[model samples]
Target: MPINSYDYYPLSWYPDSTRIKRPKYEAIITLLEEDIVSGVLKANTKLPSQRELADYLDINFTTVTRAYKLGVEKGLLYTNIGSGTFVSSNAFKSITISTDNSPAASIDLGLVSSFEQCNALLVPAIQKVAGQQTITQFLNYQAPTGTAFQKEIAIRWLSTLGVQTIPERLSIVSGVQNGLAIVLSALFSYGDRIVVDFYTYSNFIELAKLFHLTLIPISADLEGMSAIELEKICQLQEVKGIFLMPSCNNPTGSILSASRKKELISIIKAYQLIVIEDDIHAFLTAPFLADYSPPIYQSLPEQTVYLYGMTKFICSGLRVAYLVFPERFKNTLNRSMFNINVKTSSLDSEIITEVLHSGLAQQLLETKKALSQEANALFNTIFDCQEVTGHHPWPYFRCLPIPKHYSREYIETYFNQLGVNVYHSDRFVVKSDYEKAFIRVALSSSSSLEVLETGLLKIKEGLVGLE
Candidate 1:
């Protein structure tokens, strides 16, 4: 069925060119939502004329107009008569749709962050700090690398993860993302090549773009990045650094094997490349962590800047992280972090230091690991998804194979109607040619076991293409 075409300006924003099962309007809605949330469409960025978008997509003009109208209603877009339509300034804020016609409400399975299991300890930890007689110490400005007391706690936490470090080499940042930014800005220049897995964390991809760094994606398999391929790339390019999440990596949950870690580190030494090892999920994967691999920092301690994050397992609100920098780069890292952040969060640093010194942090982590196991078990009961269970901590993401004849967008929309939201594999790809018929089901964000069960059942039904 073809609608009459209308002549209009050429629109550059186009959805994936492949054939799709979702209606044009729904597809456009999803595209706008994703682009706005991902910062691809900047705030107040003007959108092409509705007819122009329709013509570009070969969709009916009325369908494009309807999509724009829905976008506006959903707080994702706004139109100015003289200037045309544009992404809303507040497009990144929570989107509230009228609940009358749509299915009850959607549960978020896209965000991987989880701290609900640790709130029992977290709330009291906050209160305990609030009541401290020396509480005023948290109100004053402190070093950008945090106070000596806080650095000591950071070092103690790293020791548990098998990365032995001292207070002298530790620099505290707001979170793991901030630590990554500091390392990249302080150590490497723009256009320097940094290697990562082909399908890596979305945040790292965006960070690479923001910092103007050249990302060389190495092909990876079930066990994680291919050391053989990485060696090939190193010989061909002047690689500066390698970024990895060795323990319970995100999205795929692929852990780098012990032998492979040693192999990769040998190559790193040969190439004289820096290693930015992200170990935020190390604590979560504690049960199985010891059996699989040691931290890369252990092998390449002189070249690795180990990012140990406390936000995931302990409390996201605290926003505290510890970076174990190479002793040689200490002066440069400290100066760069100081310029970027001015100072660390005094309150957050003090609270995390107290949390670690007390036995609460360990207990909270144990409880979280157990809860994650339970959640993974519950998920496994309903869907024939990936094997993301075991001792690994963040059971938030489960990669499911797409059913025959279903696009990621089609499956995502089917679940959307059932009040469950998920992210497709396309969002995490580092290479342009990367394609996969799969979706990432995040198990951590549902409010309760009951909600998770409901969402999982719906997801299961959709996976089989059942109505």
Candidate 2:
């Protein structure tokens, strides 16, 4: 039975309104979950309305709404039309705090990180930096963007990716995410419209939400974001920017072709849209193969903000990333970087500096390519996945069409029970009604051939079971 809205006055139960070390919305969700489980708020109890809670707590109404949405997702709350939100009957039963004895992860094929082999080179590089006579500089403060010497090394690193840019246009960031946040902050404002692929990087989607920017998802083909679709979208809306992974897109591993790049560049010029070319995986795109086409940065340097970083190819422990800002936006980007975090670690900069100059970076890349070749062979044999889109050096992930027998929900449950974690196709989609039938298999997440083979075999068995 639904509780009458007037039956329950706004319970005075609230968390410590003073100490807010975490996000306010998350804090609210935690408090609500705690109260529900402790029986302080019985099941079917009508809670305070979002507006009333916001007014009482003196917090944003949207924050309360977000908390309620998250609570619903976690099965802690339910809502009724023309009524009010109430605690779910099973909320206490569903909410169980995880412990160490929880089922161990069978395999994680979701996140794509640096190859394990990079750790070998990273240790020695750090040791070399520790032994340097100029170690005092690592302890001292540097510019928020980066020092001139760090930028010089970064320029050389960018050249490896075929990006030729001066240091004045470059800003050193802690990682690619930080660089992206700074760039987005500098270029766009709240409520601004930006364009992205229908299936794009999840992190970029989260970043868009953080900035309160609207992401218009455009349908794409195998070659990547469709320029024709983008043109139509630009005609329809006043898009401020376009965020894309041209060389090696995340999850899907799709690359934008040269002709399409030219076509998109034409549209970009016509619309004067700010372009963010996330070339993080460019270096991972076949270490041995020659360049087939120039990057968009080369053709449209003035409009594109090229993001290059070491975290993908090198170990993530060295959180080093460099952004080539358009010369006109230097002041804006520098100011944004300062307000975010003063600067990246000087020690990390020095370590990457040593690796780039000493040729270890190239050696590490070659090792990664070799490992990728071996892993791809295993994946190919298991799934016979010819439709895989990523190129050599493996692009860190492969997006394959989901077998017809299994719903994505079924696959998620099957694998999750086996302690395997996989990213569903819908997770990467920008639109809620997206119907793409695909799942991303992170090729690089498994630490070894044994683990990769085991995970793939398990997926194969699950597919067969569905049949």
Candidate 3:
């Protein structure tokens, strides 16, 4: 019997046990989907514990577990660390960005930041690496982690961002995506619970599901992930780790405040959680934020796996990312990298090393910043309601509120008809419900200032037309 169950009920969700179909787990999942979609189960409605639900339904606990796992994968539900499972924040609907650029009129506000405008600045570095006599060394499969010389460049690059670590602690991977795969495989196990921001990187969500790891989203604000919210989750459940974007968040543009960073460091140490610090936007945002603090990895070096990618900031096509792990994770991470990656394209890392060593990376940063500012300024003049603001000045994307009454399909179709692509907030939501609906519009994807402005105007026109 369920611990505190009454005949009437106290559990957050109670299914009609008699109506359950064959294959109990599938039945449970079906019921959950139906209820969530029908609005019988509200978003973030805390469901019973697996054991309790199993007991209530008079079925096996593993059946409920399997059902819950399937539900999570389907985005119908989510679970807290120690707390019971809950309906997904986006239980009512799921949204996805179409990467297809088939439409010639399509102004892509959906593809966030691969700023190829810096490609002009990268030609010298590329030519230098390709033109070298010893370039053949880079073509081979050796130095998957990175050559000693490449690691030296990584160290110097990290120092500019206030992260100081030895060569042995660093690994050169393909990029953040590849580095993330390595960390998840190396440090975490299947079914482990990890905390993420309420509005998280969508790719991370998919990647976590692939690894069979559960993600618990902590609430965040304009200053970034809330420590109090994290403390609450930690108290309620055992979380294995946290995935953070310290410099600037995707879609929302909320930077992690120094005070919040300190508070988070304390809780993370108290709970002994691993930190996956993705500092992809630091190069762009750090120079802009006057009160910018050092990355969380600086404080919790041993507990953090720092990923610095050259994707958005410098060289996007290079597909090179520098990963710095603590001494403890070195051996395990190396083995995992070797097994999963074999090698991370030494040629790519070499090109990035040249970009850094030649000081072209800094020039790229300055050029990109000027372009970002131009794009943001253009966006500001057209859309007056644009709320996100900081010294960083809208790195690549900004979020705008959508009317609560509009459906995801209706809104997306609205923009699609207007020939612009924007990502809905639901696309990035983790476990919890968002207080309001919004859309993330990218400033960097459009080819020119005029194209970006046209997209912005179309967005504005669409909003007005919808109203």
| Candidate 3 residue spans exceeding 4 A from truth | 1-74, 78-104, 385-391
Error of 1 at 195 (Å): 1.1
Q: Clashing pairs in model 1?
A: 284-393, 396-443
- Clashing pairs for predicted structure model 3, backbone only: 82-237
1-467: candidate 3 lDDT, tens digit per residue: 44555577777888989877777877787677678768889978888888888889888889889889767745677777888788876666434344764255678888786666667777877788899999899888888889999999889989989899999999999888889999999999865778988887878877776676777877777677889999998898778899999887866778888888998999999999999999999997666667889998889999999998988887657788889999999999999999989998988888888888887877887888889888887877887645454324657888778886776667777798899988777778654345678888989887778888888988998888866
Best by TM-score: 3
TM-scores of the models, in the order given: 0.75, 0.77, 0.83
Q: How far is candidate 1 from the true structure (C-alpha RMSD, Å)?
A: 11.3
Query: Ten residues in a row with the worst lDDT in model 3?
Result: 93-102
Q: Which stretches of candidate 1 lie over 4 Å from their true place?
A: 1-104, 287-292, 385-394, 403-414
Cα RMSD for candidates in order: 11.3, 7.7, 6.0
TM-score of 2: 0.77
